[model samples]
Target: MTHAIPNVLTIAGSDSGGGAGIQADLKAFSALGAYGASVITALTAQNTRGVTAIHTPDPGFVTAQLDAVFDDIRIDAVKIGMLANAQIARAVADALRRYQPKHIVLDTVMISKSNHALLAPDAVAAVRDELLPLASLVTPNLPEAAALLGEAAVTDEAGMIRQGEALRALGAQAVLMKGGHLAASDSPDWLIQEHGTLRLGGPRVPVKNTHGTGCTLSSSIAALVAQRDDLASAVAEAKVYLTGALQASDQLEVGSGVGPVHHFYRWW
Candidate 1:
């Protein structure tokens, strides 16, 4: 008997650095054994150091891109990132309402590691209101979680659990609250879905190239979901894969400032 490779779609921005956004998502999908496709919502003039400028395609073009992919291929899952503006966010939300992919992992990508704003300041409400509701899972770091909730940043495991519940109340069926920002002993994340909550914890890899950790983790979950794994199982597998990639990041140097995680760590 023959089998088909899972097809995962990433609708996000372009990172000239090749370390985050659409690039990282594609790399994660391929490294994890899934077929990947993309619709670029915005383009950024950026590198490992920081982002300088960003340009979002006309929102109409974004819709066309989504249609082009959906009309042609059957996407098993979708991963959304750096929408750039309310228009782009609404476009993504509208597409999700239309195509209704089996699984959607929305990484509420707002601020870049270099302290640049990926999404416009005014677009925050659109993301919290429009897009959050459609996602099968919403992956937000501490700051993003706080922004979505209009509260102070969640700083501990208990805070994460509370915010995870709050995020679900905002509309996401599942919430993965990433604890990478906490100055804690380990990297802990909370996954709250219809099922019971799971606390995912791992030793923090002491590496500098964690620029795309959030994108990588969210895309990894989307890829696993596309491959027919359950939501909780997908989250668990993605965490393991991201940690390994972080641990192996020291093995490669793509740029001078900060580097990217070794998305293909299994190869080396």
Candidate 2:
């Protein structure tokens, strides 16, 4: 039997290291059997070590890129990553409003794995005010959730639910509160929505080569959601794929520092 593949778009920066950003998103899309499109909002000179320099496209150019993709392709879903500043964030939010894709997964990428500041402090407002209301699902780490709500990072399961509910109030239909930052043997994530919360638990993979785990997870969700009717199932399937990728991450010798997960782990 033949069927059309879902087309997923990633609006993010370019990671020269290829471990994260547009590169990782496209890889996840392909690995999950979805067609991928990209709109580059910024460019970074980075390796697994850290981001050294960043170059952001003009907001007008960002809008142009969005128009170019939406004009031609039927985008089934959108995975949004690093928006360099307020202008770019506003631009992306506006385009989303116009095109109105069925699913938008906003990965609140505030800092890089190596502690590089990806989002400008001023841009937080744009993301919270304009982007949050438009997202179908918002994926935020502990620090990002805190940043979004202007509070300290939560340290327990109760705090995760508290912040998740607050984030949902900000207009996103659902919030996935990631607890990978917690110092525990098991990694826990909570999916918070209007009706209730769903807890997803996984053993933490003991691997240092997790350079793009967050990017990979959010994009995977976006890609899977494009095909499945149920968001929870898509999220669960995405997590399974990510866990497998993380377990196999050490196989790839990409860089001297942190390395990328095996996106095509099932293949060569």
Candidate 3:
């Protein structure tokens, strides 16, 4: 029997460098053989070095973009990233509640690798209150996790798990605590669920072209989950894909500072 292609929607910002946000999300969706759609929430004059300026559209226009996509396309899953402020977060949350997609991967993006602040400080509460409950999974790196929980960034694996649990308590059905910030030989991530926590470990790729890693991974999982894979399996597969992208990242010379992973490494 012929099967329809899975449709994945990414609600994110625009990256002029094309290494992250909506650009990275669509690349990941295509790499995973899913149809990708996007609703841009903000625009950034960004490069690998840093963000020079950011322009946020009104929240009503964000809602309009959501309406435009939901009205026509069959969105199987959604990957959310880079809500610029409280109003946009609430607006996106309202749209998600109305559409009720099967899988929603919330990437709690607060800061860029270049140390540029992406989410407003006042928006953290809105993310916890409105977006967390609607998310199937929330992927937060150490700092983002701590900011969400109103605690210090964790130093060890145990602290990561604790923060993950606390985030789950805040209403995210599951939490993927990313441990890339930790100083270790291997990169580890904990997937905390209602039943138990899963440890995903992989060797850290020694490459500087690691821009947009979070966006790529979350969108990959959303695409796989849209194809009907279980959450754990999808996470595992996405991890492997990310590892490969990181391993091959050096091949692409995209920018002066940090660069993007090879989204089409398998093909190219």
Candidate 4:
């Protein structure tokens, strides 16, 4: 019998539309040739339109799921997103401390694609205090970076670099400040920190299917890191993958609103 591939685990919320959150993370891992596992933190009544309701799973249950996966599976990397409350945040942090996985990619998912808040105000502090420090890399879009640092805006590349360095000080070994939602420019996303900074700009591809871009990007980075890619290389590859996915997204219509990027863009 053939042996199974190494696994990557995602601890995140469930997106009913299958566009983002755990769904997108798992898909990205699979498309990138890694086995995927998940411990769901919350369930959102979400679709392409927006999130109508959110139900956080019991923290104990969340913990149990993590224990089950870590105790048996060989999780080479872990991607974290959308822990809706302080308890869930603490629960996830506790699991990470116990497992000490090789890589922890934190996608600070503060708001949904439709502009709905996915995280609570108090939970932001929990994420900053408990979670960010534990991350190998934290991938935050402009708004999330601003929220994490209590800044009003991260309006430009220089601001992103400053916020990225500040996030590094908060405990992340590195930071990938996404430039997608930043002021429009010809630049690719910027990855910055005290160690170094790399501008990952590619030709901007116009597409409406971007609901899962952040989840897919972070998970792709985790997958590459699991396979021994250095921080800069992994991020670069992830950017290429995301751009292709976005460019190919013109053909897919997963929902009425913003659809999902094609995780298997390379395949088809």
In model 2, the clashing pairs are none
RMSD of 1: 1.4
Candidate 4 segments exceeding 4 Å error: 1-4
How well is each residue in 1-268 modelled by candidate 1, as lDDT tens digits?
0237888999999999999999999999999889999999999998999998898899999999999999999889999999999998998889889999878899999999999999888899999999898899999999999998999997788999998999999889899999889998788888988767899888888888887888999999999887756888889999999999998998888888788999999997
Q: Report the lDDT tens digits of candidate 3 across residue range 1-268.
A: 0247998999999999999999999999999999999999999999988899999999999999999999999889999999999999999999999999989999999999899999999999999999999999999999999999888999999999999999999888899999999999999999999999999998889998999999999999999988865899899999999999999999998989999999999999
Query: What order do you get sorting by lDDT, best first?
Result: 2, 3, 1, 4
Worst 10 residues of 1 by lDDT: 1-10
The weakest ten consecutive residues by lDDT in model 4 span 1-10
Cα misplacement distance, residue 140 of candidate 3 (Å): 0.2
Model 2, poorest ten-residue lDDT window? 1-10
Kindly give the number of clashing pairs for every candidate. 0, 0, 0, 1
lDDT of 4 by residue, 1-268 (tens): 0334668999999999998999999999998878899999999999988999999989999999999999999888899999999999999999999999988999999899888999999999999999999999999988888889998777888888888899899988889888877657554577776668888887667777888988999999988778754778888888889888998997786878888998887887
lDDT of all the models against the reference?
A: 0.91, 0.95, 0.94, 0.88
TM-score, one value per model: 0.97, 0.98, 0.98, 0.96
lDDT of candidate 4? 0.88
Q: Write the residue-wise lDDT of candidate 2 on 221-250 in tens digits.
A: 999998985789889999999999999998
**RMSD to the native, candidate 3?**
1.2
TM-score-superior candidate, 2 or 4: 2
